[model samples]
Target chain A: DQQVKQNSPSLSVQEGRISILNCDYTNSMFDYFLWYKKYPAEGPTFLISISSIKDKNEDGRFTVFLNKSAKHLSLHIVPSQPGDSAVYFCAGTNNNAGNMLTFGGGTRLMVKP
Target chain B: GAGVSQSPRYKVAKRGRDVALRCDSISGHVTLYWYRQTLGQGSEVLTYSQSDAQRDKSGRPSGRFSAERPERSVSTLKIQRTEQGDSAVYLCASSPPPDRELAYEQYFGPGTRLTVT
Candidate 1:
């Protein structure tokens, strides 16, 4: 079974607007969450991460919000640029399992300029 | 020299043939990982190594699939008697020591796409 789930397959936003991507998990043992952005034919790059102890973390124009009670998290990109158009994946770590990471399907974000 | 590098950007192999994919991690990185990504799906962890020692192999798909790292800097993933179902993009990543309080960030390579005919 999939422990991590990104229900949205795609999202669209206009330039200079806020783009939000959502993800959910079924495994309660996951204590750390991360976001990765990938371009076609390239490897995924780390974006931002948040610990279970905190509900939110921000870096520059990127922010991640985690709601432990609902087992849900989100990544927000403000002033979304054309260069920001790519697939975003949400991953979680199960510390009990030697930091094994589980990934979601991914969301393809398209920013219209 | 700066990021993870993988060899053979693309490979097409006939069924029952053996294939090897290579990964070179950044210098001084202690943790290495292998993952497989199928089309339209998320990546799945296949194995992990720390300083030339494999730490986890639970996600290995089958006996035909094996991995090794003779040194701390490079790793190889081998698939023997590859089947048609073995087609996927294999990814390699490296990271600093895993942190208990925070998730260790992994730097990934471009990946090698293997197509088993």
Candidate 2:
């Protein structure tokens, strides 16, 4: 069973618009969530993260919101740039998940200029 | 030395062959991890080693997969009796011990693409 899930396989947004990517988790034990971006033939790079203690966290044009009760999280990119196009993966882990992360299949984000 | 380095960026092995993939973690990073990304699959943790000792391996996909870190800085994932289903990109990452109160940002290597015919 997949503990973490990203329902959308792809998303497209116009440059300067807001892009929202959603993720859901089945395990309520997860306390921390992270997002990573990957380009072709490269490893996934850490993008942003949010802890359960807070409902939201933002960095530059990127914001991550977590709804603990709903077991859902979303990543928002405002003023999306063409460079933001890549595969986005949502990952989750708990204090006791043995420090191992569970990752979603990933969502491909495309920003049109 | 500079960052995590994986050797032989690509390797092609025939079915039933044995293969070894290597990883060199950043200096002083005590936590090392191995993960695999198969087509249409998420990056799945295969094993983790802390300062040369494997702490958990429940994520290992099968008996054909084996990993070892004899030292704090280097690790190797070896596959025996390779099968066509074994093709995928193998990634290695390392981070400072979480006890250090450092961000759990794992620095990853370019990865080794294993293609089994």
- Which number leads on lDDT? 1
lDDT of 2 by residue, B1-117 (tens): 488899879999999999999999988888787888876568889877777675336466578777788778898888899999889999998887778654466778889999999
What TM-scores do the predictions have? Answer: 0.95, 0.94
Q: What DockQ, on C-alphas, does every prediction get?
A: 0.76, 0.64
Write the residue-wise lDDT of candidate 1 on A21-55 in tens digits: 99999998988889999999999999999989999
Off by over 4 Å in 2: B54-56
- Per-residue C-alpha lDDT of model 1 across residues B17-104, encoded as one tens digit per residue: 9999999998878777888988668999888767768533656557777788877899888889999888999999888765533336
What tens-digit string does per-residue lDDT give for candidate 2 at A3-98? 899999999999999999999999988888999998998888889999888999999999999999899999999989999999999999776755
TM-scores of chain A across the candidates, in order, are 0.98, 0.97
On DockQ, the leading prediction is 1
lDDT over C-alpha atoms for residue A20 of model 2: 99
Clash pairs, candidate 1, are none
Position A17, candidate 1: lDDT: 99
Tell me how much of the true interface, by contacts, candidate 2 captures: 0.49
